[model samples]
Target: MDFAFTPEEERFREELHQLLLTNLPGDWAKRGLAEPIDSEERHALADLLSKQLAERKWLTMAWPEKFGGLDASYLMQYLFNEEMAYLDAPGGGGVGVTSVGPAIMMYGSEEQQRIYLPRIANADDRWAALYSEPGAGSDLASIQTRAVRDGDEYVINGLKTWVAGADRATMGWLAARTDPNGPKHRGLSTFAVPMDDPGVEIRPIENLAGERQLSEVLLHDVRVPIENRVGPENRGWYHVASTLDFERSGVASYARGKRHIEQLVDLVKENSTLSDQRQAVRYELADRWIELQVGFNVAQRIPWLQTQGISPNHEASVSKVYGSEMTQRIAGTGVRLLGMAGLLQRGTDGAPAGGAFARHYLTSAGSTIAAGTSEIQRNIIAQRGLGLPR
Candidate 1:
C-alpha cells in the first residue's frame, strides 16, 4: 500500500487545518492551556469545537453520505484526527464520535441513525461505553449488568464502572445481560440510554492526575424504549465487540506524537548540562518513534483489509497494545526528564511546559487500561494474529 496521501487528500488536510485555525474558538484553547483541568471549561470548549466540526460536516467525515458523513478516504480521516489531537482540540469523546457512529451506521435502524448520529456530531451529547463492571474488567463477557424487558421498555439494573465521560454524557451505549441462561457471549444486548434518565446516577471518579476523568454509573431499573436498542436482542455482546474493534483501530498516530517528541528532543539538546539524562531521553524517544512508525504502517494496511472484507481485529489489537504502552513510556520519560518540576500541578508558576508532561504522563497511563488492557491485547494477538490456542 502506498504510504503517500494523494494530492486531493493533501488538499483535504490543508482545508481542515485552515478550518481549525480560523474557526476554532480562541478562548477555548486559551482556557485549556490555562486550566487544562479537563473540567467544565474543557466541556465548554468541546461544545464550541463540536459545533464547528458539525458545521464543516467534519464530525462525521468517516461516515457515509446517507448518514451525514462526507464519505472521505481513510487518509483524510487520519489527517483530521491527527490535526485535532495535535491542536489539543476536543475530539468530542471517542466512543460517541468514532466507535459508536460506525456501529450505528452498520447496525442501527434508520430512525436510530437519524436520531443519534446528528446529535453526536452537533450536540454536546457526550457518550460513555457501558461494557465493563466491577466483576468484569478485561473479561467483558463476565459483565453482570441486567436488562429485563417489560411492557414497552426494558428495565436496566446494575453498575458500570470506569466509564469515561459519564459525568457529562447525555447518552450512553450500554451493554446489558438480557438472557441470563444463554451462552456467556450470547446473552448480552446493547442499548442507547439517556444519561439524564430518572433512574440513572453518575458519580465521578478521579484518576491518577487528581482529575475526574471517569465515572461509576448505577442504573436502578432505568427504563429504555425498545427503539433505543441496537441490532437483535441478546446479541449485544457481538455489538460491543464490533464497537471496540472500531475504537482500537484508530490508536496509532505518527503525526500527533511527532511534535511532542520533537519538543522533548529540543529540550534535551538545549540542556546540554544534563548529558546523561538527555541521552536517555533521546534513546527512549527514538524507540517511541519507531513504535509509532510501526503502528502507522499497520494502521495504513487496515483500510485495505476492510476493503477486502476482513475484520482487522488482530492488527488493531497489536496497534492498541503497542501504541498505548509506548505512549506511556514516552510520557513517563518526559516527566522524568523534567525532574521535580514535572510533578508540579498545572497552575504552578514556572512549571515546565506548563505541566504538560505531567498531564501526558498521567493520561497516557490510563490509555492502556481503557480500550483494552495490555495483557488482554496480547492475548488477542497471540490467539488471533499468531494463531495460537486460547
Candidate 2:
C-alpha cells in the first residue's frame, strides 16, 4: 500500500490546519486537549466550536450529501480527525458525529434519519451514548436495561454509568433489553431517548483527572415513541457492535499521542538540566515515537478498507487496542520524564507543559478500558480477525 495521502488530501489537511490555527484560542495549547469539560465555561466553548465546525459542514463530512454532509471520503474524514486531535481543537463533534450519527445512518429508518441526522449534522443537539452499565461495561450484551412496549411507546428503566457528556446531551443513543427471556445477545434493541424526559436523571461523576465529563444516567419509566427505536427489534446487540466499530476506527488517539510525544521531545531539547537524563532515555523516547507511527499506520488501514467497500470489524479492534495501550505507554513516559513535577495538576505554579502531561497521565488511565476493554478487543481480534473458534 502507498500509505501516502494524495496531493488533494495533503492540500485539504493544510487547509484544515489553517482553519484550526485561526479559530482555536491562542492559549488552547497550554489549556491542552485533555482538560475535562468540568466547567460551564468549557461547555460553552465546546458548543461554540461545534457550531463553527457544523457551519463549515466539517462536523459530519463523512456522511452522505443527502444527510447534510459533504460526502467526503473516509480518508478525508480520517485526515480531518487527525488534524483535530493534533491541535486539540474542541467542537469537532463528539460521539454524535463519530458513532451515533453514523449508526443512525446505517440502521435508522427514513423518518428517524430525517429527524436525527440533520440535528446531529448541524450540531443543534448533543448526544450521549447510554450503552455502558455498572455490570455491563465490556459485556454490553448483558445489560439489564428494560424497555417494555406500551402501546405506541416503549417505557425504559435502567441505569447507565460512565456516560460522558450526558449532562450536556439533548438526546441519548440508548440500548435496552426488549426481550428478557431470549438469549442475552439476541434480545436487545436500540432507541433514541430524549435526555430532557421527566424521568431522566443525571448524576455527575468526577474522574481521576477531576473532570465531571463522566456521569451516571438514570432512566425511570422514560418513554419514547416506537419511532425512536433504531434498526430491527431484538438485534441491537449486532447494531451496537457495528456502532462500536465506527467508534474505534479513528486516528484521533494516535494523533494526540504524537502531539504529546513531540511536546516531550521539545522539552528534552530545551531543558539543559535534563541533558543527562535525556541521553539515558533517548532510546525510550525513540521507541514511543516509532510505536505511535505504527499505531497510526494500523488506524489508516481501517479507512483504506472502508474506501474499498469493506466493513472493518476486527481491524477496528486492532487499531483500538494498539492505539489505546500505546497512549497509556506514552502517558507513562511523560510522567517519568517529568518526575515529581509531572504529578502536578493543571494550573499549579511551575508545572511542566502547563501540567498537560500530568493531566493526560490521569485521563489516559482508562484508554484501554473505555470503548471496549483490551481483553474484549483481543477476543474480537482472535475470533473475527483470525477466524479462531469461539
Candidate 3:
C-alpha cells in the first residue's frame, strides 16, 4: 500500500511549516520546546504561541465548524499534530486541546459544547486531568474519590496524583465515584471543575528533570455543578475509554518520534568526525530513521482508517506501544551517542544540543508511563488485538 501523503497534504505541511517560521516566537525552538514552561516568562511565550495557533484555527482543526474548528479533513488533524511535533510548537495547551476537548465534543451536553469549545478552540482555556488517585491508576475503575449530590452540586472529596498541569490550568476534568455501592466499573462519573475553586488544592511535584509540571491534586469537599457532569452519571468508564482511544490515536507520539529521529540524523551527519566508529554511528542513525519511517507510515494509516469508518482500536494499541517506546529509545540513544555532553543540563557551556537530549531523556520516561503504560498496551495488544483470553 502507498504510504506517502497526498500532494494536498504535502502542501498543507509546507504551509504550516511556513506559518511557524513566520509566527513562532524567537527562541521558541531553542528554549520553548526544550525547557519546561512552568515559569512565567516561558508560559507567557507559550501562550502567545498558542494564540497564534488558535487564530489559525489549528488548535481544533478536525472539529466541526459549530465548535470554532475549520471542519477540515481528518488528514489535516493528522498533519496539524505532525507539524506541531516537528516544530516543537507549544500551541496545544493542556488536556483541553489534546484529550478533553474532543471528548466533550463527542459526549458532552449542548450547553457544555457551547460554553467550553469556543474557549478551548481559541486558546482561552487550559485544562488538567485528575484521573489517577493515590492508589488507583492503571485500574481506574476502582477510583475511590467520592462525589455526592446536594442541591444542584456534587460534593467531591479525594486525592488525585500525577495531575499534570494542574497549577497552570483554569479547569480540570476528574473521575470520582458517585455510587459507593455500585460495581467498580459502574459507579464512576466524570466532571469538569474549576481548578481555582476553594476546595481544590494543587501541590506541585518536582521530578529529576527539575520541572514542576506534574502535581498532586487534593479535592476537599469540592462542589461541582450537576451541569458539569460529562456523559451520563455512573457511565464515566465508557467516556474515559473513548477519550483514551482518542489520545492513543491522535498521532502525537509518532510525530514526536519522527521529529526527534530527524534531529538525530542531522546531528549524526553534522557532528560526527572521520573516525573508526563513524560507520557504526551511521548505521545506528540509519536504523532509527528506518524504524521511524515505518512508524510514521503506520501512524498515517490510522487516521485514514478512521475516515473510512473503521474502529482502529487494535491498531491504536499497536501505534501507542510502538510510538511511546520508540520515543524513549530515541532519547536514550541521543544520550548514549552524545555521551557525557548529552547528559549536561541547559546553560552548561558545553552541553550538547543545548541539553535538549538530556531533558528529553528524563521526560521520555513518563511518556511510556502516562496515557496508559507500555505494560497495559502490551496487554491490550494481546487480548484485544490478538483475541487472546485473559
Q: Which candidate is the best by lDDT?
A: 2
Candidate 3 structure quality by residue, lDDT tens digits, 165-275: 888899999899999998989999889999989999889998768989889999998988899998899998878877676566636776766666666666666674525
> What TM-score does model 3 achieve against the real structure?
0.94
**Regions of model 2 farther than 4 Å from truth:** none
Candidate 2 Cα lDDT to native: 0.88
Clashing pairs in 1: 189-236
Best by TM-score: 2
Report the candidate with higher TM-score, 1 versus 2: 2
**Candidates 2 and 3 compared by lDDT, better number:** 2
- Candidate 1 — which residues are off by over 4 angstroms? 23-37, 251-256, 275-281
Every candidate's lDDT: 0.76, 0.88, 0.81
For model 1, give the 10-residue run with minimal summed lDDT. Answer: 28-37
